[model samples]
Target: MEPIPNPSSAHPITEERPGEAPIFDWDWTETLAQSWETLLLILSTFWCILLARVVTQKLQLHDSPNLCYAVEFGLVILPCILLITVAVDYSNYIGFVMFSGTLWFLRKNRVLERARTRGQFDLGGNRHMALSVLRALTHLITAINILAIDFGSYYRPYRKSLQFGAKLMDTGIGLFVFTMAMVSRRTHNWSDLRRIAVYSVLPLILLGLARSATVLVLGYGQDIHEYGQHLNAFFTLVFTKFFGALLNILARKDLHLLPLGFGILLIHQFGLSFLGVSDYVMNDDVDRTNFFNANREGLVSLPGFVGLYGLSIYVNRWMVASSLLSYSELVRKLRRLLLVVLLLWSLFVISAYGIGISRMTCNLGYVIWMLAIGSTSLWASFGAIDFVINSVMPWESSPSDEQEKGLVTRGTVAKGGDKSIVSFTISQALNQNGLTFFVVANVLNGAVNKFLRPEDRSNCESVIILLVYMFLGTRMAYELLKRGIRLA
Candidate 1:
């Protein structure tokens, strides 16, 4: 063997070469995995908004005026604290710095405006000035926290700061609730409540839809850097859209919907808790992952969150129909049975899609999961609202004289000469129908992403099919929206 060198042995011959090729160094930080932290951070931020809104609505219903003010204050203050803490630990100080700069600019601009408007400038808006000052202080604290989080190599150094920030935020939130309770005792107006409800709920629905879309689009193509950019863009877009919708809703004073929405939310929470117990026993492995990430581990995984959310919504819908609805016992039982069946069916669909199709792709299952979760949530929410409205405010005809005069009663559809009834009926029907279709589209979208990707057990043909389905769904949504607008 030594006498005759084996031709197959390329290693020995290559070793005799003068120099070895240089190995390219790869940085994990440049990859998508590293950006998971950013995604989690953004998710937490969104949760803050959701919590604030939910709490605000709850307080509003109790007629607590001071509580509302407190909630608003807490909403601004608490997040600033948490964000500051996280920023400090993660060395992400930009948010705090930008916030401070914004305050300074606003103050200067206010002075200039006052000077121009009046001969002598007077910043005598003491309350407003105090609030601004508080905001500045919060901003400064947040900036410090950001620096600590982003730059702190060791967690120990920032642990105290983190705890302190959380405590401050919590205390601020508590104060806000207390204030709202005090204020609610003095206010009572049903019409105003209704207006608030409509405005808040509608905008939330739209904002949720937009955010879900942004997540799906951004999660596509498996490019880490692009993914980060998309995540940032999604946050920015969500903030803008939510605030715009909230402003519009506020202008209309449609606050009454808060109670109904809060009720639905409470139902949703109960459903989620039930699902958690069921999932723990039935899907131990998945449960293990979810628990590890959500509880034991600090990392927040999107799929785990969606899966839990979807289960919660499905459960909530059942609860609303069976427990909350004013149906006969038999009807309630039947509805419960049907809900269980649907829940099982949805689970089957998701599992099959995941195992049979999603194994091939990097994050396709997650994308589909998010879409499905969004759709289910919207459907359940709307359905709950419908059920509550019908139960509490059943359609009733007016007295003979009122009816003859062609006046439209609160829940009654007007006849012949009045088009309001027809319009109202059409709008409600279209909205409900549109929501159902939207849920179906979400499920289908998930299926496509799971089974149609090239990495999945499919070729380009799968993608084509998926695209066609999406196109059809989009067209349907557009038509529904048009009908809705006409009715409105």
Candidate 2:
């Protein structure tokens, strides 16, 4: 094999190897590639159908006791599968295709109109809950699939998967909203359902099983054989440096988790940076063991790293405060903090982009990804602001003409002589579904960045930056929540 080019020193931009061109046709030589594409499409669609059915059933059984089951499946199972599958292959394109197809079906059936008129409620008046479940499920699945597939690795397959998955998720969500609109129009008084249907129970159970199986079947051997040594070392370090601090926090109630979390994060950053720099220095020859090469190798292995990080954060946080605060309070504060951090982060990221574009040999794709992160952050920040504002503001009274037209205007007078401000406000905020999108988008961005960027910096630097931003963001979020709660 030809010697690996030195990334630090002068290196020529290499030409593509034969058959490595982006638009290779599906001939005998590329049959395996084509087959993989086909398999992904089929599997993704199957999963989509399963997801849609679960969502539909959840909405239908809104009053039932199994409501939480749907929520759990949507939030946990769907996202996990999405993450794993997206990492596996070109599943994202399949999702997009499926989503688009779903949309067309909904449009043809007039489902959208019905959904809008009904306020997207189910027949039993739990539209919001149902839609929330569905949206979460769809997004998680989509995001996971996207993460699994490398965009540039197999260009055509990756592109197709992304397109298909995007369309599929969008359509699934659209159908859900449309159904909800129709359901919301109906009026009924009902109790939450307590009965469980086989349809719901079986699917969720199977999905759970599948997710576990997938993790084990795909991850077990690789984790043990390939990454076992390094992973064990990393975990040991994490335990000594981070987990120990976390346990102390748990034992001492007075201890603050955030500071501990931040400190651990900083340590992680330092460690990663040292490793990256040391690896670079040791591999002075123009070999595949250089800093950039090591970085790429680490990047490719980041999902496991991030999973550990998430676990560390959760364990630390949960140990200190059983219930940190109420969801409402959390949401309120998180929203405000998100807005401020997003603004600052956007500026910093933009500066990074300028540097990357002007000085570094970055491509259009890198620029685009950076821009997307900025855009999504801005969108999510604004969404949180909008939710907070609407929640606090009094609703405007509807005109008599709107009343005559039987339209649910901004704020209508109720029989109790109180305006429907509270109801309207809460409804509007929930309907935006901003929180769901924000989480999904952030996760997706992280996954993309982990894979795409040139791994010049050490793990320490990356971890440090991540921790610093997260700490600042969380702190701001806490303050915002406190302020909002006080105002209320």
Candidate 3:
């Protein structure tokens, strides 16, 4: 998923010409009053975790671990379900509570608590499962946001009553990808870098070139994206993310990665500005509307995203470099996280007010704003959720406890985790299997567009279609799991 999609960005949706020019509203990113609801939602999400956790822990007389897991999962997932179903203004609030709470809950048991202080992050309880669950949730939410709406109108989306808020998938992907990357850190060696390059980056680059050729040569995506920028997200992963890691490995300077990347970005920004590629020359409607793959957007924006990728490494290094032993220790760590958030927020405010917020250029202000908001939300949401999970379920249930209670047995997953249709059924399907679902989803979406043509369908029909697609994807994941198949 390319972050901050332009109206005309590549991604096949039912095409409908607008009577009037479509408006791109971004006031909430600037004004405090307009953005008040979102800020409050962030707070409300954290509060939801606290209240749910505390209440659940206090009423834990059920004396059944399975019952407790079921109850906890329900309490956390309910708000998210409401948000996704209703859409509109409430989406961000519930989405935040859901992901952030689950993230914290997962972090309750540290796999490498002592190593964390020395700059290592090893989480307990089937990390692959955790990552899969989060990615699946992200994909699921994005699917609902895009597919379940009316294709008649970009905003209206035929029959849907509420529009999804921007804050949902726009920022969610960044956090999860970074979380995934951070968990799998420490491959600065050349052999490992080359292995990733051959196995992942090169394949992605080729896929991107093929996708780009669909537009540039065959004229598939000529309506929305430009020839150059029409290359798919695989290009983003290969060029922006993997390219950065390759640079670090070549330089053999892992510690100084972000600073170096930032410097490179600064040079690119100024170089683009000097070459008439800046806002001065390309301020026209065609340029703004068809910003994808534009020379400025397609080429120049790479450094910005790469800078963000580099910064994620640095941020994750600091984040997982330490761990908590007690509630009081968590409180201290949280305060530190908040302090960093405040400082970053100050920088974001300065950048937005001083320069401006431009998603097109992947401007410095926009990047800072993303980090500031993402870090605070992740920290606060995760900490609170972890607290509650720890209170309800022991981080490591003893063999005796499991044997006596006949509960969720030790190390259920031989490779991943328990295959039972338990409390985390949907998440388990997705856990460590998000990519397969994503690829399946895209292929199926294209097939749907070809056959069903969602643009012609009514809103009710579209929603039903979306449900079918989702069910199909989930079933695919489940069957794969049963057969011990995985798409990493």
Candidate 4:
């Protein structure tokens, strides 16, 4: 085996010394460690969904979404960051809070009885509560972890280990791609390609170029291993979107996406396994002199992510179809979703044992790992929405009207002064323009890193800094939603 290269040496322009960059220098944990961490994240996520319902629906708490934004900041985003940061050491305490909080709301409100009698509240196929919550949390967690990973309170295990195994931050880029695919509308006609390019691809390319330029100019500490010498998160997103758009136009039907996606994955994995592609990407001794070698991680990983994008489009098609089914049929479809999650997890385990998980290469194990996590999160969020939250706060809309329009405004106030069932929520706000929100968070992360040395801070200081940063970051999304803006 070739000797491993210093992760920092590839980015000699950064101010960081050899092997001392706070974010880049870390040995990752075994895959088994991710299970416990994932459980806590899921638990906190479920609790956030429940609490959002109880506060906005049951209690009629929306005097103004503006005033209530702080309530969300404290209840939903705060505990979540705390669970992963300052409060991480107290797993039992945090776990009890998440468990008891979710249980208390469920039992105290009598979810089952309400669900049985509340009648059906259809918000159409696309604006699903379960999927909405999942998408929101994806943005929330990704935003938090980017900045949190620099702090002393942030555990090393949660950072992107790069070399092997799965970590929370490691899953961020793939989840973003998957979530974007879930809502991607099928494009028809080459004429639409220009609009897609201008609206979608252009922004991502600009963001990628901007980030790459800023990092080099500011001499920010970078982990070249994460995306190679020049490529960053934005470029990965750009390529994913660009390629996915071409696929959508060429396929011309949702039905074609599933099988085609699977075929792509199989072929990609074959090359990695048999063609020695994985060996080349993982070899640290390789020099980063050419564009391909310099950005090999970003380029090689594109196929896996594009395949994931195709697969997610199929999953979204399934969900849209499932939403139109009768209650019993919907339940069965949901059960099937659970089974899909199980199958993905099994595949992930098999792949991990066979080739090991590597985010750098976006190898078979990494792709399956992403699918398993994304599917499980979607399942849990959907289960909560369908079984509990939907019944807890029913939408008062006629069945015929819902069927005809197949849409409901997210921030609509219920008629007859009934408590606003679908009032403004942090998740709803963030979902308005998720990509823009992510960009704002990245800017703030860079700013914070420039002024503060989080690696040297105490737990209390770190938590306070993170909370302040989160507030400022979320505020942009929330305020933009208030102004009826959607920057994609």
Candidate 5:
């Protein structure tokens, strides 16, 4: 789906909100109603998996440490596309059959066997967790995005889902930037930002300008700012990268610089509110729609997300420690990490209860919630999964250890590799070439929205069209990864 501008920091807070409208008629009720049977079936399928995991662990049914990574992607990600694209009417019987088969398609995702390496808690643990959640998030959005609507209405029960769903795409974008910046910090000097900015951000500006011009010149006025594909480009190229560069300067590669970035983000969040910035965006229809909307969204709403990038630096520091420790010592660090997550969650709860959720204005509450939820969930998930796997198979062998014994790193790996078969294809593809696929989605969306009649399409037709679009994107991603190319 095309990115909307500064679409108020995202999910739980934006239910049927008034400011933004969708590109198409998205009846939340209708969409959910039509899909509920299938939805319930999917949830049940997931439930069964969870139950099976518990059973396996309890009974020690499968001592295979690698079973931690087993999952049926064909069922989890594929059949949903198939069901939606062809508009197959949901039948409990058919769903049962399909989902049952999916249960049998388990494959290794190569998740971490240990939470720590040497003496420190491994940051790679979070990488695996984020990759899993992010891929699932990507796939869900890609599926629903076929209709090309934001589903931003707060009026629906799915308001929370809608908001988080939309927010996930950009959050993923910001998360990666922060993570890579942590990586880059170890390699590059501060002075390299200008060169990096030019190489990265400039292309986005040019592409955005080109897309905007196409909409303006060709009379494609619908969601013009968004359709032009500039919003994400601005966030990724400008705010995410450039702003990060400046912050990196201030951070001076010192871990102490993290608190500074965090402090600055807090100031930005609260200072703007005190200055009536939040009031203006929330109440001023004209300015909100203009400044906060697509055209110059980067101008108004990016600070919080940029600040998020800033905070990620501190988080990376927390996740990555100098001490290489034994497994028991790493568990101590995990306990402390869990404590930090609780504190963050407390902040989120206080902020939400105190100020209420508002995306229209990038309020302090919004900032706290996103940062707290995002960071906490990542760490907690990592810890939880690592704990479960380790407890289940204390002697599990990883790829490195297995290789010493001449075993394959990944079992019976396919041509497209683990990414294609392990998790959802769309996310695997998007992860491989997020920027390129994003550009492709925008260009293709603009064309389809301009030329095609979404309103007249049957449900099955919409599903098929979206599936086709996602497939092409996936193919492009596979090819790009195979060739070792990426715009990002």
Candidate 6:
């Protein structure tokens, strides 16, 4: 099946009145508190993972796949959706989760101690699974907020801005690009670049074109300032990929990717700050008569994304190496990841004071902000998943031991060894077949908007609709996994 263009940014939720203003024409992005609050919402998901691990282990839920998935969905996925859309006071929810998790750990302190002393409890599970979890959650959250932002129940402060600010929705695109960079790293030769341009880059451009055509033909309401007159997220992906590949060729093999990435980011930052690119892009008064002016947001934002792409490549390289490490080695790698997060966050704090965090323009602060979020998210997932596996498996029969005993084999979340870790399986399915999941999500998002009128719905109705949509989309991903179908 031909994949549907993702409707994340091209949403047509409500009709404009004759003289009514555009829905996405907000003056500035929401405040740091709002963005941080929403960003910290991921902690709820981490809590869910930890809690679900305990519940499943206690009940021996992995004996039945159906029952296991049901528990995971109820505990991990459902609450994540709620936290993103309807729930307020996010810190409270996170705190409650932490308290509950602490109590459970305290009760199992003996088991944990025995496991740790026996050299069994350690952060040595599959790092690849950790990366997959991070990617899946990012995709899932972006999918949820894209539709939910149109609803009355959804927080208005989470909406993307036309000009500037670190809003949740706009941050979604940057996060997506950052993950793409992490996953799509390569040392492209001339032939490889040509092949990538044809096989990889061409399809993304076509996808962008398809979305543009779809919006025009279906008469979906579009905000020109979001990606300017004709571009969309796919185009941004293409630009980032093109530039990243071109730069890789220029850098050759000797130069380290991290320093090269930093240089690109510094140059981009200079252009945005010292050079007038930021002013030109943010200036609404600029006439959209020329092609450059028409797609200024998409064009001007490319360098920052490319810089982000380079940074992710370096990080991903580190992750790939860490995947093969032992427990002690993995701990050192985790510390390195933490340092990366702290450094990026420190840079973001300093840069935002000067250049300001503008996801619209993809400014220096925004790049660091995204890199920080991406790294922090990956670190959290890695630590959490590793903790769950190490803490849970020592008490029960480890999957390896289970196989030796001829017992029911625990399922593996990622490739490599049989850790038999309990995780959000829906995320595994979605990560396994992301293109299919996103296509299904975007098409359904449009269908829901067309039929249900999310903006008019009550809070109760909105939550119900979002829950149903998430269930169906993830269920479809699971079904596709069962069929061994990867649409991309």
Off by over 4 Å in 6: 1-30, 99-127, 252-255, 394-423
- Report every candidate's CA lDDT: 0.30, 0.31, 0.48, 0.71, 0.45, 0.68
lDDT of 1 by residue, 1-488 (tens): 01222332211111222343222112222212222332233333333433443344434323232343345335533443344332325424444554465356446545333323332211122111112222222222322232222222212222221101111111121111111111111112455445534643354455446545744764433222211222322232233223323332333232332333334334433432334421222221333333332231111222222222223323333333332222344244445545654564454245333321111111222223323332332233232223322222222233434224322122333222322221121122223233333344444544444454423332234324433553454344334443333211
Residues 104-162, model 2: lDDT tens digits = 65566464343333211111122322223233333334343333323222122322211
On the 0 to 100 scale, the lDDT of residue 345 in model 2 is 43
How displaced is residue 297 in candidate 2, in Å?
A: 7.2
Clash pairs of candidate 6? none
Q: What tens-digit string does per-residue lDDT give for candidate 4 at 270-315?
A: 8877787776676666789999998888898888888888888778
> Which regions of candidate 1 deviate over 4 angstroms?
1-364, 383-488
lDDT of 6 at 399: 46
lDDT of 3 by residue, 368-417 (tens): 75577567655754453343333343233234433333222332211102
Which prediction has the highest TM-score against the true structure? 4
- Arrange candidates by lDDT, highest first: which order? 4, 6, 3, 5, 2, 1
* Candidate closer to the true structure by TM-score (higher is better), 2 or 4: 4
Tell me the spans in candidate 2 whose CA falls farther than 4 Å from its real position.
1-255, 271-331, 340-344, 347-488
Location of the lowest summed lDDT over 10 successive residues in candidate 6: 21-30
Q: What tens digits encode model 6's per-residue C-alpha lDDT throughout 66-108?
A: 5656787788777777775666546565667686866677567
Model 3 stretches with alpha carbons more than 4 Å out: 1-122, 125-136, 148-180, 206-229, 250-255, 268-276, 280-296, 322-327, 395-425
Number of backbone collisions per candidate: 41, 44, 9, 0, 13, 0
